[model samples]
Target: MKLKNNVLVTADWLKSHLNEPFVKVVDATYFMPGTPRDALSEWKGKRIPSAEFFDYDTRICDKPSSLPHMLPSADTFSKEVGLLGIRNEDTVIVYDTAGIFSSPRVWWMFKVMGHENVFVLDGGLPAWEHANGEIDTSEPTRVEPTNYQATFDQTRVIDKSQLLEGINNGTVNVIDVRPNERFLGLVPEPREGVRSGHMPNAVNLPFAQLLEAGKFKSAETLKMLIESALSDSKRNVASCGSGVTACILAIAAEYASGDVVTVYDGSWTEWGSDHELPIVSGK
Candidate 1:
């Protein structure tokens, strides 16, 4: 299906353009708290040909923040991306091992940093395998770093204070992408000290609902699901347990409805941890 914003690129497309110098593939695999897999180790074992590992968890984040993988400053983003051999003119394709999981987070990160030519791999690594794409097991070759410049777009992100203000004023529609159980506070949060409920007035639209067999559903279906949850609101904000899965919602919304959905970078990790922030349980 053709998306309005072209946010996704198929495995076949990557395979055909694999040799192009301007097309850079990235392995953005990230496992949550209890997951046993180590992203860096897996990348070293096998990955798409010429794909580099984008370590959002450690290397490319706001290291000062206690929260998980918070957005790094524009200077940090620029330097890290430049080290990945990416230039401003390159077309980046991001993917993850678990089909459509953490890849969109990197994709959204690039967008927030004002890089418009980035796309997430549709169905991720599993899709590439399905398409009979060649995999490289040899150690990655280091490419010469480029002078990548990132222009941060402030409107693409929101903090807890700004989100609260917008919610209070009835100007923003907050879409919480956590599981229904977590959104309702029926299950304990994976992170220590974080609460299990959602933000006040936040609508829960689990990220899984937007995917079918590891790939996004048709644009028509995505539009339907998002609109049903959002109702009539236009100013959208996406949030999840940490900051990662919220990006899946944001990128999918952009694909479905040609408008940008701002991500709450700290998400529940920041909101639920602080007692001052109001959280509501039970839908």
Candidate 2:
């Protein structure tokens, strides 16, 4: 598919240009809490030809944090991505088994590193296979690592303290991207002893709403969703059960409102664990 300014690309678009040297496809499949499928095994078994595996959990994260999959340091990210043959100017297309789930994190990672040519494969691997696209079972040829320098933009990330300040000052809109049940504290949290409620003053906007059949909704729909949640406010912070799906909201906000957005790296996994922090249940 022809590359666009926003976050997604169709399987058909990818099929048409699989041979383009400048286009690099990455398989970024990941799962939550108790998911049984091994992402690495699945990627090795079947993947789009020439695609590389971008391990979301192990390769990218803040190792110092107790939280799972927090954003990694620029030096760490640069080294890891560089080993995968990713360069500064290459156009990247990231995808996962689920249409619009885990891949957005990789897309967000590239963006946070100040790379603008990245895009997520809409509907991901399932969408591509459903369209009768070719999938090679053989492993991809490994290439020499390139230099990948990550210039981390601190403005794109929000910590717990920053979120509290935003809530008190009304400077940023906090968006929760978990499912309605999880966000409202109606369902059991995957993390043991973690409460199910959301951060106080945060709006509920599940990440799924931003997608349709694996692809992102139009900019018009995204705009409406953001406006509905934030009203006149433009600045936003996104959070999820952990920190994965929150990036989906961040990408959508960028596409829809063009607002400066941040992702709470610890998210509810950290907040819900602490009883001292305020959490409100129900919409």
| TM-score of each predicted structure versus truth | 0.96, 0.93
Model 1 Cα lDDT, one tens digit per residue, 1-283: 1233479999988898889878999999999878888999999999998899999999999999999999999999999999999999899999999999999999999999999889999999999999999999998789889899999999889998899999889889999999999999999998999987988888989999999999999888999998876645557899998989999888888889876889999999999999988889898
- RMSD, one per candidate, in order: 2.0, 2.0
Clashes of 2: 3
lDDT of 1 at 198: 89
What is the overall TM-score of model 1 with all chains considered together? 0.96
RMSD of 2: 2.0
Q: Report the poorest 10 consecutive residues by lDDT, candidate 1.
A: 1-10
lDDT of 2 by residue, 108-127 (tens): 88888887788888789999
Q: Rate the local accuracy (lDDT) of all candidates.
A: 0.91, 0.85
Per TM-score, the best of the predicted structures is 1
Off by over 4 Å in 2: 1-4
- Candidate 1 residues lying further than 4 Å off, grouped into runs, are 1-5, 231-234
Deviation in Å, model 2, residue 31 alpha carbon: 1.0
